[model samples]
Target chain A: MIGNAGDMNVVVCVKQIPDPANPGSLDANNNLDRSSKLIIDDSDMYGVEMALQLVHAAGSGEVSLVSMAPNGETAGLRTALAMGAEKAVLVSDDTLKGSDALGTAKVLAAAIKRIEGADLILAATESSDGYTGTTPVQVAEILGLPSVTFAKHIEVDGSTVKVQRQTEAGYDEVTCPLPALVTVTAGVVEPRYPSFKGIMAAKGKPLDQVTVADLGIDAAQVGGDGAGQKITNVTAAEARKAGEVVVDEGDAFQKIVAFLDQLKVI
Target chain B: MAKVWVLAESAGGKVSSLSLELLTKARELGDTVEAVAWGADTASIAGDLGAHGASTVHDLGDLGTSLPGVSVAAAIAAAIEAGTGPDILLVGQSYDGRDVAGRLSAKLDKPVLTNVVGLAAGEPPVASHAIFGGATIVEATFTGSAPFIYAVRPKSFAAEPSGGSATVAPLSVPETGATNAATVVDRHVEERSGPQLDEAAVVVSGGRGLGEAANYAMIEELAKLLKGAPGASRAIVDAGWVPYAYQVGQTGKTVKPTLYIAAGISGATQHMVGMKGSKNIIAINKDQEAPILQIADLGIVGDVHKVLPQLIEALKARS
Candidate 1:
């Protein structure tokens, strides 16, 4: 399967997050509340879409998803599954409740390995919630695979992946061999909404649920106690009090200029 | 007292402002502050790092066209294995910084406290991170091991120079194997003028409410009149109205300009986190109840297309 142009198997790492519109709260252990219903993170949709497109471009390949969440939630996976992903591998266990970036990476790396012949692994550069933005690289390290993060565009060539990696100044053309992991930035591609037929087909797709123990990772090393950092205290940030709100009476521009004059910034 | 190591980044032979900010904070938290840098121009930044509080500069020299992430991380991991690591490693949340921190974390099996906005000197070095779009602050400490890694946010501290010089030291990058295979074959820089978004004194940003991609010119024109920079909300950037470099949000650049003007932008929390630190915020939007109005110093409820032209004409008249 290596370097074959036609049959590329891609794995997309997806994250299930709480709605960003709603305010989130911390739990008793100082963790962001995950008891609420979770949906697929908006950022991951691009990766899923990119993977599906890559597979389709290869003419004969399938897209699989790997995710970690609480309560064995498949609500998010089902969304990607509906987006034409062939299958999913989910790692869910009570022990993963307070896992940090490294811990989460460990679980994800383990889940990814179970897939027999994934030529490429994909993920968003960071999750909307818990934007540590480090999991993909850590996963690459664990699997000993080359990785390219912040990919704005990706194209698979034979057994290699070429990426337009985003940088501070601009973009860099980067190339890595197959069996590599790439973290895509948002806007890399426009994600497609699941169609009626796709939604119907997703229900029958295979979703294998595994625990930390099943992955041979010690339960003790994948949870709160296993986290490398501990939350000591949490407090509300100093709030910026409300200022004057004015209806534009056709002269609001004067007020803006006046405000700038006051700040002496204009 | 703790020994601190700051990851310094340089471009065109000058160190980044964020690296200086990190070094300033590192000096305050540790007894001895050192810096680590890569690239062919690493030597040129030693004086700047030293003036910012790093007494020693560890130069990894040039790695040809190979990405610095793998080699830099491997070198640091090797340093730790050789029992020469610092008590705390402060990394600016730059692109390369994240990659090195992540790979090193995996190699050392350590955890990194990322998005750190504040730090305190302590046994384990407590780091404060802003969550919920800067609504809450969480103070955390590493549970195990020294050389606690922290990926700090930009503009969290001021960069103050002490007028000192650094002693340059050569550090070696161990063999990182296939993980280092990703190579940079070409580089492209999108030509941009005016002050940088993160460093500008005055910033004018547009959102989806700007209506079309062409409308962003108003933002640029206004910013230019104010001698500042033009920025964008993630909505516009993601929608292809502007490049990602112009984006201002949690995932984008955090800008704490003296004056931040939001035109036709209903603030999202993600976008708020990036610009909430501005000294003065003025938002103009038709939706009076837009979240951005809540924190803006002056909130003008109006259509951007109308307000922008009038504001631009008024500013032009003043000049």
Candidate 2:
């Protein structure tokens, strides 16, 4: 009872994050800084790409995006939109500043429900930043939909979604009904860069910005107040002291082998 | 006295070492330590769990091809609703563990603390997580509710057996209709040689410094010569030079081997956190200033292309 009628409506959960290379420090409240400009997470791009490809394979569907960013940030959504997504629902509220993983999932699931007729949902296994790695499955739980994580490959046959779910050992072929959610692994597909025409088209794409109140979520149930955990303190980890530094004088391998020998491991 | 429950996993009728590690940590944190497991072998592994300090084992029985995420989570939530749940639930940072934790969090409307590396006993129990690729350690504690869930990283604690026996308790999985629709149709375990990456005493990891994908063969050969395992940095794994399973870094496997040999790896903080715990580290790189060398017991400032072959030959000659 899950397959769609040929037109597969795919929803991708996209996250806009601070650049991992120049990651910002925690603010006074120990929350990650998001006041500055943000870009789409590199990890989420694979989900975006997978969503687009699935829609393409379905022949008559569209890819929609759901994101929660501060200040109604549309920059990250624009990138995904340029990649041929039809529209997006952005949840931006001042009260959602210090939202934890569960709070964020609540907001996302609320926003996703607004998109009608979505047959499948996709998200990255974990974000590049804030790798809580539970948002997609949490969203599925809230929506009462089946979920699969760590997908290296995905295909749609009729109403069933088949995923090659990645595991530490290898991978498992999992099949779920339509209207399910999947968290895609990174590098599953090659994401396309935005071209001039796509970028221009993205500007006109419908980016419906909403607030917590608009999504029928209480301000008290989000941000720091609703968070179930608090960061009591943060300190530098004990650094390992630097050890012997010897420039390889042709006997470097010998020294290494000797060290291994000393350890009785070789 | 706080009650702690660990989500245990088993394969080949043996409890996973990570689960035992969690059980060990749970014993240190709580007066009552219990375990929750699914699958047909749950009863078979109860004794092992008991030896690891679990006094009680909640068995969800066999799932019959259905993924454990939905049913296992529902069963735990049902227990909590019945006022028989633990004060804290510790789950390993694994695929099924994350799924169960996330679903249970949603079901109970409680937040979960993930990436935990340390824990200390307290009224509510505080957990420590490494942030920014383990550069800064953040100590956090639950604020809202009991049965606080923590997804702990593997190898964070040592698994020790304390002589005991656990009483198996049957827990029924609530009828989860649509959410339990996903089922495993097939499984494929890749052919692996040598010891497992995390369990291997000697681990030789390569990086982008290996120059090309073909050069990874040297890493495999050297690890084979040393009777060890092969690993890789995120750079080469992202480059598609190797599978993600070989990755050893912030987002990958956490290895604490006796001897770790990093070849051509620049030792990004992300990479360092994963292998820095090794008892002895040896870094071979052309760049004398590579960060990996700083923590290495033996720093060999040389090109891996030249140094690896020599090490391989030297190791081969000895054998």
Best candidate per TM-score, number? 1
Please provide, for model 1 over A136-162, each residue's C-alpha lDDT reduced to its tens digit, 9 standing for 90 to 100.
999999999999999999999988899
Q: Residue by residue across B128-187, what tens digits does model 1's lDDT show?
A: 988877888899998897879999988999999978789999999988889999989999
DockQ for every model comes to: 0.86, 0.71
TM-score (chain A only) for the predictions, listed in order:
0.97, 0.93
Stretches of candidate 1 off by over 4 Å are: A1-5
lDDT of each structure?
A: 0.91, 0.89
Model 2 clashing residue pairs (backbone): A3-A159
Considering the two chains of model 1, state its CAPRI-style docking category.
Answer: high
Indicate the residue-level lDDT of A192 in model 2.
90
The segments of candidate 2 whose C-alpha lies over 4 angstroms from its true place after superposition are A1-4, A246-251, B285-291, B300-302
lDDT for predicted candidate 1 compared with the true structure: 0.91
